[model samples]
Target: MHDVIGLVLAAGAGRRLRPYTDELPKALIPVDGDTTILDIALANLAASDLREVAVVVGYKSNAVEERREALERRHGVRLTLVHNDKAEVWNNAYSLWTAREVMSEGALLVNGDTVHPVSVEQTLLQYRQQEGSEDIVLALDTAKVLAEEEMKVVTDERGHMRRITKLMDPSEASGEYIGATLIEGAAVPALAEALQATFERDPQLYYEDGYQELVNRGGTVGTAPIAAGTSWVEVDDHRDLERARTIACRY
Candidate 1:
């Protein structure tokens, strides 16, 4: 097994989630009681036995900084804060790129705003340990109904990703990429380069575009389907926040 750390991308401004996001980043929004979205993310990572974590912060980074000690004490993990100065102006491609150094050792990557169980992390790690596993593996939700907002995936017969983008038609998608990925140490250099290219091509491009760049270069990206009926939600709006509250307490 590789020495993997938990990596979280929590730098988005999340403009659509205003008021809640006016003073804090989207990751700081409370979904269940006092447990913020980032808290669930850190808790899940800690439960997966990842003691070291790197969180990319921006868009009111001070809020996260202030809670750093409390979060570390609560989760029992040492955190390294990676600052993304461009997080407010650019999209997540640059935010992800900011953590390239930490990611070099390999990482179980999760979006900070996603509320999911520890099982999602376990699934990705288990798949990565199997024979013939790809260097990059994504946790996919095949049972969910796809929509334009979902980051959809199209895979070939062998389960290698053929396409990953939000622009694709939902009917053609194999599943939704649920903002979780396992990146092996061997894939770091290429992924960093790909992320650079993606952000340079368009500052507003997503980190998923970096995945597409790798796919276009003939890299194999594998997938692990999340167990059917498992509850998860990516809180992008008040409606999604309400859904998160409903499912998160169960986790």
Candidate 2:
């Protein structure tokens, strides 16, 4: 198993998941009887032996911090809390950049809003088995096409992702890029470079822009095919929340 440090990006405004998120941070929105979305994410990480979790918080920052602190206290997992002040002006990519200083090599970048039915241990294991082949190993669901609001990844026949686009047209999408990804330490410098250029060129763009830039520059972004037909839900709207709740109960 990789000595992975998990960076959970919980700093989004989550405008899409309004009403519920209108008052509290998205990570705190309850998914079930007691577990919040972020709670599930942390539990998943803990199960995979990735105990160290750093959460990046922005909107409703206090609420996020309190929730994280409580979870840390109860679970006894070591968690580092990070804050982003510019979340109102920037997309999630900026929230990610804010945590780059704390990011460790072979880090698992997890989106706080995502809840997966599958274990990330399998994904991490695949990444470890691949050895020195690529820098970023994305967990991909090859059969599903995500919605327009979701990030899309287009991989070649060799399972090498050639392009990643935030705004995708159905005619162009190949698969849904899941929220969890394993990034090798070697890939960090290039990712940082791409992000720097992106901020200079279009500071308003999402972090996916940087990933796309990496692909455009011929960076090695590999794809690991994850549990086919497995359920993976992104809680972005009320419907999504209901769907996540339904799936959460069953899973």
Candidate 3:
């Protein structure tokens, strides 16, 4: 197995979250009592046996810096903060590109704002160990009822991703591409180039667009379906935060 690192993209300003994100980045917002979104992300990575974790911080990054020690102790993992200088002005495609160095060593990437159980990480890693696994494996919520806002994916019969975007019709999607990915070290260079192209094309584009870019360039991206009844929430707004709180405690 590759020496994979844990990567979390926590740089988004999450403007829609308003008051909660006014001072803190979306990742710092609390879900469970005293346990913030970043806390859950770290906990899940640690539970998956990832000893080294890199968090890309930008908006209100000092908040994460201040809690670095405490979070490391709580999660039993070493923390590395990768700063995204343009976090406030750019989108997550740039945020993800900022972690290219770490990604070069292989990484299990997770969205900081997402609250999920360790099973998601475990599933990705498990899929990586299987024969015929693709270079990049994305966690897909095949059972979720996708909406326009959710990042959607279309796949071939062999489970290779054909397309990924938020603009596709929901009924045409195979599932929602939850904010988790297993990236092999070998794919980093191509992925970095793809990401750079994606952001340069449109700074507002999401990192999922980079995945599409990679696919367009003939890169093979595969999927791992999250187990049925698995609970997860991408805390983008107050309503999502409330849903996160409801399920976070269960994990």
Candidate 4:
């Protein structure tokens, strides 16, 4: 429990979700009761004691801004808004790069579309405190069944992440990233450079590509495997949204 900032990437339009996102961004979509995906994210961060948070917003950002004061009061955290004007055209690499200054102190980043228990955040913090650990730690779901839609990861024998992307073969992946990561202070510059390169190469690049950039620069990014029986879902489409609702209420 050192001082850490919670960084959330909530800029995507979630086009695949279509009509559900016709007026609202995916983060505002209700999954359990009336709670939103971003609500769960904020609650989890607050529960984990990461009380200061920065949210990168785009694609109907007013939806999130409108509730900013209430969400801050409810979660017991100071919330900062970072805007990504290219959220619609560029990928999350740029969205993440937008928070470079706020996250320079240290950050725990979670994608806004994911729904998981607070234990996921807890496990990540615990791992970060371990000896010989670095600033970058990815929350991995090694026990879960893999699928094409999930962001896949491959690690070396020593457990450092070797690859993180959805384009890899499922059979080649060691686990799924689950969109939660501890980006330590030491990783700030490398991550920033990587994210910049990723966005410059193509606006459609994922922030995970930034992690790969850090690796290419010889940065060590650890992986924290979620415990067995821990449930989570990343809502990208109608079917995924249904799964989120099913598991969310149980949380």
Q: Least accurate stretch of 10 residues (summed lDDT) in model 1? A: 125-134
- CA RMSD per model (angstroms): 0.7, 1.9, 0.7, 1.1
Clashing pairs in 1: none
Q: Rate the local accuracy (lDDT) of all candidates.
A: 0.94, 0.77, 0.93, 0.91
- Residue pairs in steric clash, candidate 4? 135-184
lDDT tens per residue, model 2, 1-251? 44768778888778888888888888888888888888888777777767888889989988876666688866557898888888777776677777776674667888888888546546755567755657777887777766777678887877788778766685677777778778767678788777777766876876777888888887878877777777778888888898888777665
Give the C-alpha miss distance for residue 174 in model 4, angstroms. 0.9
Q: For model 3, what is the alpha-carbon lDDT of residue 194?
A: 99
Write the residue-wise lDDT of candidate 1 on 1-251 in tens digits: 67799999999888889989999999999988999999999999999999899999999999999999999999999999999998889999999999999889899999998999999999998997799899999999999999999999999999989999989899999999999999999999999999999999999999999999999987879999999987999988889989999998998
Q: Once superposed on the true structure, which residue ranges of model 2 sit more than 4 Å away at CA?
A: 145-147
Worst 10 residues of 4 by lDDT: 1-10
Which scores better on TM-score, 2 or 3?
Answer: 3
> Which of the two, 1 or 2, has more TM-score?
1
Model 4, span 139-162: residue lDDT tens? 999988887778899999989999
What is candidate 3's CA lDDT for residue 83? 99
Give the range of the ten consecutive residues with the poorest summed lDDT in model 2.
117-126
RMSD of 3: 0.7
Candidate 3, after superposition: displacement of residue 141 in Å? 0.6
| Per-model TM values vs. the true structure | 0.99, 0.92, 0.99, 0.97
